[model samples]
Target chain A: MRFDLIDHAMAVTGAIIRVLVYSILTLPAILVVMSSFTNGETMSFPPTGFSLRWYRAAFENDLFMTALWTSTYLAVLVAIIALAIGFSAAFAINRFSFRGKAFLQGLAFSPLIVPAVVLGIGLLQLFAWLDLTQTIYPLLLGHLVLAIPYVVRTILASLTLHDQQLEQAAMNLRATPLRVIRRITLPLILPGLLSAAIFAFVTSFGNVTVSAFLTYGGRVTLPVQIFAYLDTSSDPLVAAVSSLMIVVTMVVILAIERLIGTERLA
Target chain B: MLAPMIILLTGFLVVPVLGLLRSSFLSGNHLLEGSGFSLEQYFHFFSDSYYTSVLVETFFDGLVVSLICVVIGFPTGYSLARLPPLARRWRMIIVIMPLTLSLVVVVFGWLIILGRNGLLNSLFVSLGIFASPKILLFSRPAVLIVLVQQFLPFMILSVMSVVTQIDPVLEQAAANLRANRFATFRKVIIPLAVPGILVGFNLVFVLSVSAFITPRLIGGSRVAMLGSLIYERIMAELNWPSGAAMAFVLFVSGLGFTAALNALAASRFIVRGRRHAL
Candidate 1:
């Protein structure tokens, strides 16, 4: 009887703690959505009234839209470049046994440890000194550097899970290395590649620390623009922009959940 | 295969970082001049009491926030680990949603949630707890709250991954030995979960100390962590050397903390392994 009572108490404790913490973590995004619809001049919680004024404000604002476009294209370009390079590196490390393989692996993953602030400043100076800051190449390259490690890691994970004999069997049948890769290796890791694309896209799109210094001329990424905007205004339009991002993230996360189990993501 | 990655990472990431290091030690205010070396920048940085205080405060803030994450996240992660796959999937979404949001957007969401006239104040007003919206933004508590919201995902995910790897049969054995739920949790679960807790703790701590955006956006002018201070040096003062020094200090401190933590976690792991072997 006492044991059952103790179990009941623990259960009750777990239920209450779980509910409280999850709400605190999740409800703030809901509040952002609600407040973005406010009719008032300034933001208020529970919102004063419902209107899409801020949505209109966000749409009408040129800075937000341009930055959004810049960020989108930058992310797309980064996904392509990082995917191409990262895939080859991952394939090499996974399939081949060679000297310096561990060193190569460590080098590929080293950026995960370096502070983004450091990377931002380093790239900023590198570009400015080389007179490359005037173009978007710095931004492209910086995001590429940041995004590739993730791509390599994800593709390697898929490679690790795949059985080796299928590729060997294809090779034994007198298939060329390129043919084996095109027919067997590429088809097997498509899901991993897709996830890597998503990973690269999101990292590049959302990056600020690196882009903060590398944003050349009038071209700013959305995150950098939003951070600057928040410094000057406390208006609900920022909330509207944020809400849209929240919605997009929700959708991407859901799509990923469907394609690959959430277990593979973290 | 390795040629592309090697060339890209070396030419960009590695070379630039070397440039940054060289820039920090330059005699003049030149960016990465290969001509000369000096320590005046480091001297100027550590000589000032204000800069020293910022470094200290950044460490303190990281320690406190990291502790809170472990406390809150361990329990929460364990709960998620206990859930069935279907239930866990939905819960994982709720957890990862905040993580997936852009840093700026995440900070913006919290800007209102903890704003003066925002959610907390609104709740208080409706419940007659406060007469009107109170000032909560740009304060220490506000900064702490936002930092937690931003990085708690790291903690929860780390702990979850480790916790899930532990065998459920061990807990079953504990229960069968007449240990109650609380006793089993204390003896079997906590020991096994230590690795996750340490992993989560290191990630949250390392990321917390190096994070610049959360401090800049939410903490604002009132709070001066190393990240924001480094930003001021580079952006506002245009003093590259000083900023580089501060960034290194931040990076080194993170390295030291993690190294110490690894030693602690590894020692425990070795002892545990030996016991199992015996």
Candidate 2:
């Protein structure tokens, strides 16, 4: 009875410790947003006042607006391009019994593991060799490299979950491959496509290490802007910009959740 | 269709990374400027304690953070697996939220949370836990906290997928055979769960080791890691060769660690399979 009692106490203690650690881990970003309410000169805890002026500053600031648009534009372009490539590759790998299928799959997935900094460096070097330094094309290509793996992974997972019999049935019915894909496979994998696209968007939008290296002053993305802004000034402006970005990100996440119901995403 | 992807992968990823390896070999005082290579950069990396320390730090950070993720993620993973099908849908949202969110946003969130005048300080003040705001940000502990938070979902989902594959009846059988719940968990559940746990460890470790932005923004200059060192060498100093060397070292070390773990996993899997076959 004493041993059982001791075990129960130990388990409870472990649970409490786990809870405290998890809560502490989740608190940092939330607290930063709350700290922005401080009307003081520097960021201070337990703000003397609460107002949304910093949020107002983030919107009104032209640089922030430019960076936001840049990030959004790049994100959208990256999604479209990545979807085109990733989907095609996924289709080819899934449908065909080709040589080097595993190798191709590994290649497709390698970008996810390869450090962003390495990708950034390699692309920077590649583009420089091609004389495309600090260009939008390089940034686009870099973002696509990062985004492709996510799209491929999500699409592959979806493809695996789906029935092969449907495609085989379509083939037996004398349907052309293109027609069958359009009429059968596309609809089945639309959820995956949607999920993949969301991932592509987020990957491109939130990229830093790769985007940071690729971006110049004229075409700085939101993260680069945030990094630069934080470096230059440790003020409420950065807090506001970060908060604004977070809100935008949260809205997109919520929208995706609403659209597909987050199960499809998982 | 795969041709284009294959070509892109070969040209951009495989070749460039290979080129980085070659670049690490070439010396400034070389026989040939373009082609002839020496072991100068590798020697530099190995010989210099400053750069070497960064490698060690990176490895340890990856180790600590991934382990923490496993510890935190296991129960969450179990809870998720046991959830009703309806509630299981929301579990992905919770799981992928951090994964999909921009690293900038995550690091920013950490900055806010761990910053001097951040959330914890205010909470502590209110609760009378601290007399004043404390400096928690930029510390090594803060990096682990932020990283574990960021990677926990990955670890959880990885384990949960495997856990769900397990038959609950095995647990019931164990119980029926006079085992307590804890004994059932230990004997029946844990062995089945090891593969998932190892996978989660590999994924999180790979991520944490190569991570630059997180360690940079949250950790400050005090917490030097290989990724950040490479960044400084390349971006700050424009020392591409040295930066490439550091990146190559990090890449090699990461590859080695994953390979070792995977070999360990494969052998263990075979052993388990043999036992089951028996």
* A85: Cα error in model 1, Å: 1.3
Question: For candidate 1, what is the TM-score?
Answer: 0.95
**Model 1 chain B poorest ten-residue lDDT run:** B26-35
Estimate TM-scores for all models.
Answer: 0.95, 0.90
| Lowest summed lDDT window (length 10), candidate 2 chain A | A1-10
Evaluated with DockQ, which candidate comes out highest? 1
Query: Per-prediction DockQ scores?
Result: 0.65, 0.44
Q: What is the lDDT of candidate 2?
A: 0.76
- For model 2, residues A1-266, the per-residue Cα lDDT tens digits are 22354447646855675565456544645655676676777766556687888878778999988999999999999888788888999988887797878988887888878877787877766666677775788788778878778889888877888898999999999999899989999899887787788778988888887887887537889888888766545777777777766666667777777655664443
Candidate 1 structure quality by residue, lDDT tens digits, B169-217 = 9888878878888887777787778878887777777777877788887
Pairs clashing in candidate 2?
A: A28-B113, A29-B109
At residue A207, candidate 2 shows an lDDT of 81
Q: Give each candidate's interface RMSD in Å.
A: 2.1, 3.3
True contacts kept of each: 0.69, 0.40
